[model samples]
Target: MNKQWFVVYCKSREESRAQLHLQNQGIHSFFPKIRKEKIIRGKRSTVEEALFPSYLFIFVDQEYTNFSKIRSTRGINDFVKFGREIARVSEETIKRLENACHSINDLKADTQSLFKSGDKVEIKSGSFKGLSAIFEAQDGLERSMLLLNILNQENKISFCNKEIKKAES
Candidate 1:
């Protein structure tokens, strides 16, 4: 019998743990992971997290490995199923997922940030260098909108992230 892919259900946030247990048992498994970036405490940090939370893929065949031990394995909830019908994933599907994740492993969460409205900021460069402004919002990954009161009217100006820095009060 050809080895078919099956989805393993793991406990909450236990995909890594279950993957390790299966590896020790000589089972072939794939736990797709991705790197995510988050802004915490006004500083940015990157974290490696499971692409499919609490789920991993395992290759199985009736003639090769005994699938019975999977359910009893620590950190494993069970094999994913639909009303007693076990789910089987095709090899092509798994391969596609592997390729997709590999391509984005080095990419960052460009649109995520810790900045919010009303935060004070200072333009570090360009025409408004060293000027203090109110942080309006992040326009995109590389741009932010700041509010500056010019001529007694609020003027919204967009600045690239590289051109601005958090101003200390």
Candidate 2:
């Protein structure tokens, strides 16, 4: 059977439960999780929770007509859809999800904060050295920036993620 990654929709807030059900039925399933800290009752605690709260992935025979059997299970919501058909996620996407499940580091939310408004900064490296670009916003950590081009300056380029450093007084 050619195995393909398919997104399965679990009942609202029941991803883990559905994964367990699939396991009991001898089907392969995966539910990605991440550890995050939250303040509960004014106390900080870490919890390992589903990275995607209502979804999991499964591998099954493409020609299997048993999709309805899975869909009718108690905790299963549905297979993810593309209009009238189930959507197939790429193998690469599924591998990424698997990596997240086995990682020990804290899950990172995409919230890189770089340069801000009204901030005075200098480009520490790259072709724009000595020319100060106004600190704009975080461009993924190592590089943060401001637009060097005024209007007609098409030659100005966006800085690389590793090309920026904050200017000092």
Candidate 3:
């Protein structure tokens, strides 16, 4: 069979360990991570975390590495299985993920742009500086309806465009 990329499941929160194990064994693998700034204990810090937690991709070819060796690898639970079949991922999909990972690392995370409907935005100025709300639409590019939660219920309020910023999430 031709070499194919297949997703492998690892123990909870063990993606990095699993990737290290695969590397020591000389297996080809990819583990995508995203870098973001977070306020940790009142201090700003940058953390690189897995884009896909608890899952890693491995390239397996029957001509070289045996499937059993990969299955018995440390930190790896098993091949992601569907019924009795182990699904193979398309090369194009893997390439796209790799490119995205590269671009994300190269680009800074603080980019901002025009707000759209259903976009979660945080009030950056005015009386509600820290509140997050869902954007509805802009009226004449000045005011827009923001859906906010109060008393466990959604309350739509209109606020000017300059008072809001896109939520980090």
Candidate 4:
């Protein structure tokens, strides 16, 4: 049987733990993660979070691997399935995900901004509360540049991501 990639559903916040258990059992698994900047209590910090929370990928030959053992692995819930058929991911898809993870990891930690240029956003706090703006660029880890229209003039302003949110379409 050819080895194929399959999706595994893991216990909440247990993706890393499940991957470790699978590795210990000689089962190869892939858990993609990305670095992100987050603000907590006015402090900026970098965090590595799972790209697909509570899920991971495993490579195995279904005909030879012990499905029962895999399903019962510590920190693992079960294989993702639709009805009775197990979910399978193509090798190309896995490769693409791997490449994307690598590219993101290679970029500077603060470069992982949530909004892009021309993105519609709303100021949720501060003096600009109840106003809409267009995201211009990320100033730093916590501050972002936005284009706001006020008094019949287009003004560029900076605000924290915490104070801005994507405008509802």
As a whole number from 0 to 100, the lDDT of residue 43 in candidate 3 is: 58
Query: Each candidate: what lDDT?
Result: 0.81, 0.70, 0.81, 0.89
TM-score (C-alpha, index-matched) for candidate 3 = 0.62
lDDT of 1 at 143: 74
Q: Model 2 over residues 38-113: C-alpha lDDT tens digits?
A: 7668754567788888888888888874898889777998899989989888889888777766664343422255
TM-score of each: 0.63, 0.59, 0.62, 0.66
- TM-score (C-alpha, index-matched) for candidate 2: 0.59
Residues 1-169, candidate 3, lDDT per residue (tens digit)? 6788999988888888888889998888998898765767975566898899989999878577777888888888899999989878999999999999989776642223467789898998887889999988654334667899888999989886668788997
Model 1 vs. true fold: TM: 0.63
Candidate 2 clashes between residue pairs 3 or more apart in a chain or in different chains: 114-138
- The C-alpha local distance difference test score for the whole of candidate 4 amounts to 0.89
In model 1, the runs with Cα more than 4 Å from the true position are: 108-169
- Which structure is stronger by TM-score: 1 or 4? 4
| CA lDDT for candidate 2 | 0.70
Per-structure clash totals for the candidates: 0, 1, 0, 0
lDDT of 4 by residue, 25-98 (tens): 99999999998878768877678999999999999998999999999999999999999999999999999999
**Shift in Å, residue 150, candidate 1:** 13
> Which candidate ranks first by TM-score, i.e. highest?
4
Off by over 4 Å in 3: 109-169
**Highest lDDT: which candidate?**
4
Candidate 2 vs 4: which has more TM-score = 4
